[model samples]
Target: MNNIENIRPLISVIMPAYNAENYIEDAINSVLSQSYEEWELIIIDDCSSDKTLKIAEKLSNNDSRLKLIKNSKNIGVSETRNKAINLALGEWIAFLDSDDLWENAKLEKQIAHANKVGASFVFTGSSYINKEGKPFKGVFEVPESVDFNKLKRQNVIPCSSVLVRKECFETIRMERDNMHEDYAAWLRILKSGILAFGVNEPLLVYRLSVSSKSGNKFKTIGMNYRVFRSIEMNPVSSVYFAGVNLVNSLKKYNKILFKNKKIKRLRLTNPL
Candidate 1:
């Protein structure tokens, strides 16, 4: 069953860019530095007024593995990603947002784990980074496996940390600009009884921006409720799960903040 071609399956990485000129180069560089070689990166510029397209163009010119496209109009992230998905060539699909960074061996480890466990959907644990690229205090660890029932309450899979089979998107695609598109899509996929495996190591580093909706806990909770609603969840149940999600999310952030405070105190006392 394994041949030279089968030995190294191609992976198409979908990256959607919108005014990400500042970090686009670093994001693309991370993909270029991956230990996995059989991968093609498709970067679609979402009509950014910034220099994102020019920078990606320069990189794509240097490497033939990159496929670059620019939208004629401003399409939202959900649609932008879907457009890139339509052009993907590999059976494997990986996502890396323009602003997020991946560890050098990210794809290598993820694919190795997938083959070992026969996992169709995979996500890695991640740590958060500030806009200036400083590491955060705590890591967001993921369990070995999560089922629909567990994921229904809260989504542990980060969009940039996901690696799924291309065929999985045949039915479901990210939508709903106002809500959490990726979360909704994951819920639908897992609802079909597909179990998602997690790589606990922090292979993905997510960038936290003050302007992003995810930075606002209250707004994200509302978005979580909307995600439940998109899946036809009852209002009462959605509210219940949303509340539970809020508490869990707050606990995680609080833990990170506490660790940060501890480190600051130690620095102050020891004069490090």
Candidate 2:
């Protein structure tokens, strides 16, 4: 029989929280309840003025696996995540937003699949949840495997749903500090010729709150426009692909508007 402890690699789960007092407990509990026991939860408090720090400290006091890191000042999410990455001591790094919760088997399933395929980065599907904790019917479809070319067309990898090998970070440093840091980081990784594998299962509950920056569709579109502009400036394959993605992004924005309209109608009729 394999020695479970010896064979299991330590996975570092990093959470960058700012004013997440309402949902941080659920996030912490989700990590603690993971079937993969050999993992550490690192919660970095990004100088939240709310009770987020107090809640994190309370949880850390109860569980030895949970750690609390308070930043001296409020930095953006990118800087907070990079700080957590620098402090991580595990072979693999997993990220969870303060408002997101993982399925109980998320880490176990992802780690197993990563080991099986020898993949450097693994991402899984996620179910969108509203602020009330109700799961939405709408789903995001991510490809099973992503190459450098495919990633250029669209960024299907969800930040909260991704688990990346520590070594991948060594080659492609996460330096993007824009509003769309996740997209920039993924682009950098793909540019370095690293491929990411995806598990089609919805292993995470992605919270969609009005308070979240990503919930602002217009801001996302503007940031994406900037991403394409940066990529177009690159000498290789810019002229063709950048134009393609620009059109695709326009279509995507239209679809999002349509969906929002339907959702609004449903809310009016159903009164929820």
Candidate 3:
């Protein structure tokens, strides 16, 4: 795959940039430092009012593998990602938010895991970090594999830690809304009777921005509920799943918030 004839790239990284000047450099640098070389990073700037586009342009200029596109107006993140997806030219489609960072071996290992498990969709466990890039209390654990029923109950998949086949996107693309569109896409893919596997290790560092929707418990809960409803889930099942999601969300933070000496330090690693 590293040969020049395979210049099409093994993975297409989709990054949606929206007022992300504060952390865009770190995000781009993280990708530039990846161990895997066969990847094309397509960064879509959603008409940012800040220096996000400028920084992205500079990074794109430095690396031919990186490309930057701008939207005529300020579309939401979901739409911006879809725009990039449409432009992807790789067998594998990976996602990396403009603010989050990934381990150097994230792509190489995730692709190997996908081939080993024969899965079209794969995600990894993640460690949470604060605005200053310091470790935080929330850590998400992942199972080796999950079926539709298991995923319908709770979203164990992290968007930033996912590497999906491009065909999956053609089958069920992401929703255009801002409210848990990633979760919705996961559920839709699983509903097709496809199993999504987890790497069982934290290959991605999830950044927690208080201003983001996921940072707000109340807003996140509401968005989860709406996502369930959007999938045509019955009211009873939707409420049940929402309750389970709430419990899982609390558990994520509790793992770190109540950390003790017995717990190992949370860091990105290929535990497998």
Candidate 4:
């Protein structure tokens, strides 16, 4: 027989939230529904003006595993996440945006994979969900493994789907104030000679809100370029990598659009 109390938590989830009242509850519920029970969720409210903090507080009261941390002022997402990471107690740290969700088996499967291969960092595939919580067309499929060179061209790792060993951050932490800071952090990890593995299953449902920074495609492009140049410190390398990122991004969305069109055409022709 297995002893529940004897087993220490393997993962600590970090969620940095600001003005997430509309969908934050759903995100919390997703964690509550996880099949893996030995984990902790630390939700930091970044001085949200809305009911985001209140909701998180209410949920935390019901479960000891769920913790709520409120910021004194509106620190950005990067700082909020870093604070939570610094306080994390589990051997592994996982990220989940306040508005995104995970399938019940996500932690269970990812932890097994990590133990099997001894990977320091791992991410899974993710699909988009619209404001209405309906499945969208864009689905990100990542390669099996990524190194510094492969990641430089295109950052296919989704922050929300990642599970990283706690010690990996000993040398590098998330850049507190930068566009695409998560991308910069991942690049730093890979550059340090750590191999990141990707599980090909879509274990995350990333919410696409129009008001979000990443929802603005043009702004994201500029941010990607800035991240490469400013952090990577090579204008020529930045341009080459930025170009590859742009082209790959276009192909990803175009493929989604094409699939939607083909489905619509089939529906019209078959009257189904």
Winning model by TM-score? 1
lDDT of 1 at 165: 95
lDDT of 1 by residue, 130-208 (tens): 7779887788889999899998766788889999999999998999778778888889999988999999999998876
Among these predictions, the greatest lDDT belongs to 1
lDDT of 2 by residue, 1-272 (tens): 53542368999999999998889999999998999999888899999999999999988999888879999998878889888898899999999988888999999988888877878899987666777787666555567899878877766777888899887777555544553567667777877888899998889788764343334444445555556555444544454454565566556434434655544422100000
Give each model a TM-score.
0.91, 0.84, 0.88, 0.88
RMSD in angstroms between candidate 2 and the native structure over all alpha carbons: 5.1
The sequence of per-residue lDDT tens digits that candidate 3 reaches over residues 1-272 is 54533333479999998898999999999899999888999999998999999999988998999989999998888888888999999999999988899999888788778766778899998877767787765567899998888887678888889999999988677775746888888888888989999998889998764332334555566777877887899887777787788777666556675763333333221111
State each model's CA lDDT, in order. Answer: 0.84, 0.75, 0.80, 0.80
Q: Rank by lDDT, highest first.
A: 1, 3, 4, 2
Candidate 4 residues 1-272, lDDT tens each?
Answer: 33532344568999999899999999999999999888999999998999999999999999999989999988798888889999999999999988889999998888777766778899999877767787767577888999988887777888889999999887777764547788888888888889999999989888754342344455556677777875656877776777788777666656655755633211100000
lDDT of 4 at 125: 91
Worst 10-residue stretch by lDDT in candidate 4? 263-272
lDDT of 1 at 153: 61
Better of 1 and 3 by lDDT: 1
TM-score of 1: 0.91
State which candidate, 1 or 2, has the greater TM-score.
Answer: 1
lDDT of model number 1? 0.84
